[model samples]
Target chain A: GESVGLHLPTLSVQEGDNSIINCAYSNSASDYFIWYKQESGKGPQFIIDIRSNMDKRQGQRVTVLLNKTVKHLSLQIAATQPGDSAVYFCAENRNNDMRFGAGTRLTVKP
Target chain B: GAGVSQTPSNKVTEKGKYVELRCDPISGHTALYWYRQSLGQGPEFLIYFQGTGAADDSGLPNDRFFAVRPEGSVSTLKIQRTERGDSAVYLCASSLNPGGHETQYFGPGTRLLVL
Candidate 1:
């Protein structure tokens, strides 16, 4: 896979701290949203997802918050680790159509 | 179970050339998708297939890009008269089904470079 987020904005976080990545979706009709993590040389992997009916969803150490009014979504990673260093993406889906946002680069430092 | 697999992990072609990229989806997965990713950007959806039929292809940039999944498992994305802008990592993903927004498992994409 291509290495993404080379020139995108980056967020640096210390290990053991929490990191938040945000995204603004384009479609108001989008009902399903998903967060993905892509490490260098690997394809995007599913992290967490939320639907318009729900404001929040939690996975192991990750949480997804959806604000439908503003079309905003965010992923919160608690106790971030070096293994979490990667580019994060938010995607919106409606009627089987999914659109991804430009990713945010997360660099976790020890 | 084997994950999605793509062939020719890397490909470099000349402008105006034609190329084909292959994808073998996970066994028994009924939903398949194609996406193109450029540097600094997220993977853009290119096409989606349900069974052996293309369910959606609105994401395809133009007619120059075409895909086929006749057997409902193996897919091939074909590009004609390639341009520099067409160079990117082509990713393939598959899920159990299309509804309910099932998680899509992706393969290490095919890196295409048009010189």
Candidate 2:
């Protein structure tokens, strides 16, 4: 019954601007969360991950924030570029299995 | 050799047909996973293999779906009596360890279309 979901189904942002995508998970026992980017016709690529023990984690130009109390997760991309345009997914790791969210389609327009 | 590779980048089969998808993980990786991705949706976990044995296959939808990793390396996912709903992209991933927390490297995935 564990499921990961997102707040926004799609998001459009201007190039060079910051973008924030949110996700919600249904499992409290999940110990780890990850973010992935999938371009069309390609598999999902690992972006960054955060442990339940940590509230925030940063990688490259992206930052993942976890709020355990509300079971909410967020991914922030600084100065987003056109190449950042893709479907971003949030995944929760529980019982050695990873469940992915419905994903948010991020469109960065020039 | 560097990343996971799936065979037959695309497959089209009719209903009630049997199809086998193959996945070759990165060398020396100890864990492999299979997932199904429907149109406009995120990937759904189908099964997980640790070494040569399947650690978890509870995610497999029904008896029509099965997979095997005999030598702890290459894997094959078999589906019997496939239906229209079986159409989806099958993804395979591998990690260095069998733990829940590890960076998974994914393949390009095989697109299956059941007509």
Candidate 3:
């Protein structure tokens, strides 16, 4: 069985500060990892992804780190803004199927 | 240029009733997926379609859930004898192909409320 889980259910950070959301997966065979941001009344939006062969991938202000050795994944948002407030999820893709974590609600305070 | 679109943005049905949710993927997309998201939870995979056939449906909770992607363009998810537990946001996503590495573009989703 494959399970993806997040360390923090909710996180609050001051605007302009860096935000990091952590995720842990049980399947060591998993290869692909993706990060998504979902706002209220909307579907999950793809942010970035990292493959098992890669340890890190960056896009714009977001970076995804994948540690296959520990089955850990993380999404880092730099200079977070109020609009960045949303529920962030990490999904592990294995065999063309993706398993998502519970999600971490990120709140950026003014 | 339009993203994926879902019909009946919101659906309210009673227990034991049947419900069908529709999803229109982006043009030229060869892979489509269905997911269910409960309150305060991340979206859970329900099914995936490559072209007109179901590539994988292992995520379906039970026999009560079914989906189809005829013509390899549009897909419909059918729920039989819906239960209160069936209430959730039904999300549809599509990628360029069946490749596991492609990014999946999602729709707004259809909110299903089974009373």
Candidate 4:
């Protein structure tokens, strides 16, 4: 009985604004999590990942926050741009099986 | 360096036919995984290989779906009696694992359509 899902299915943001996508996972034993961005007809590109040992990890223009107590994960994109428009997914890797949340579509408007 | 790659970016076939999807993981990546993504849904795990052996095949939907990694570099997922429901984007991912600390890189994926 394990599932990973996002809180929102779609999000709209203006260029230069910030965007936040949230995910909730049912497995408390999941120790590793990742964020992926998939553009149309492209693969899910690796954005950032956070281990259970760390609460936060940052990358170029992106940040991933993990809250183990609540089994919640969130990805924050700074200065969101048109290029950032895509579907974002959060995944939990446990027991060598990676489980992905449905996804959140982010549209960047001019 | 080249990223993980899948062959035949797209494939269309008739129902009840058979198809093969191939994945070439990044060089030196010890772990490879396969997933299926439907329209508007996240990719679901199908299988994983550790080196030349299949460490996990539990996620495969049924016996008709099979995957293998020989020589531990390339993998092929074979489907028998392919059905319309099997039409989806098949994804492959590779990760350089240093124990639990790892990040998975995905390939473009093969978009399969059953007619």
**Native-referenced TM-scores of chain A, all candidate models:** 0.93, 0.92, 0.91, 0.91
Name the candidate, 1 or 2, with the larger TM-score value.
2
C-alpha RMSD of candidate 2: 2.6
lDDT of 3 by residue, B46-96 (tens): 999999999899989999999998899999999999999999999999999
User: lDDT (CA) for every model shown?
Assistant: 0.91, 0.93, 0.92, 0.90
Q: Judged by lDDT against the true structure, how good is candidate 4?
A: 0.90
Question: Which residue window of length 10 is worst by lDDT in model 3 chain B?
Answer: B37-46
User: Estimated TM-score per prediction?
Assistant: 0.95, 0.95, 0.94, 0.94
Shares of reference contacts reproduced by the candidates, in order, are 0.75, 0.71, 0.70, 0.64
Worst 10 residues of 2 chain B by lDDT: B96-105
Candidate 1, superposed: residue stretches over 4 Å from native: A1-6
Encode model 2's per-residue lDDT on A1-110: one tens digit a residue: 12343343888999999999999998999999999999999999999999999999998999999999999999999999999999999999986789988889999999
Find the candidate with the highest lDDT and give its number.
2
B52-81 per-residue lDDT for model 4 (tens digits): 888888889999999989899999999999
Candidate 1's residue-wise lDDT over B1-115, tens digit each?
Answer: 5899999899999999999999999999999999999988889899999999999999999999999999889999999999999999999999989874688889999999999
Quote the lDDT for A51 in model 4. Answer: 91
- DockQ of structure 2: 0.56
> Which scores higher on lDDT, 2 or 3?
2
Most accurate candidate by DockQ: 1
Q: Model 3, which residues run further than 4 Å from truth?
A: A1-8
Least accurate stretch of 10 residues (summed lDDT) in model 4 chain A? A1-10
Residue pair clashes in candidate 3: none
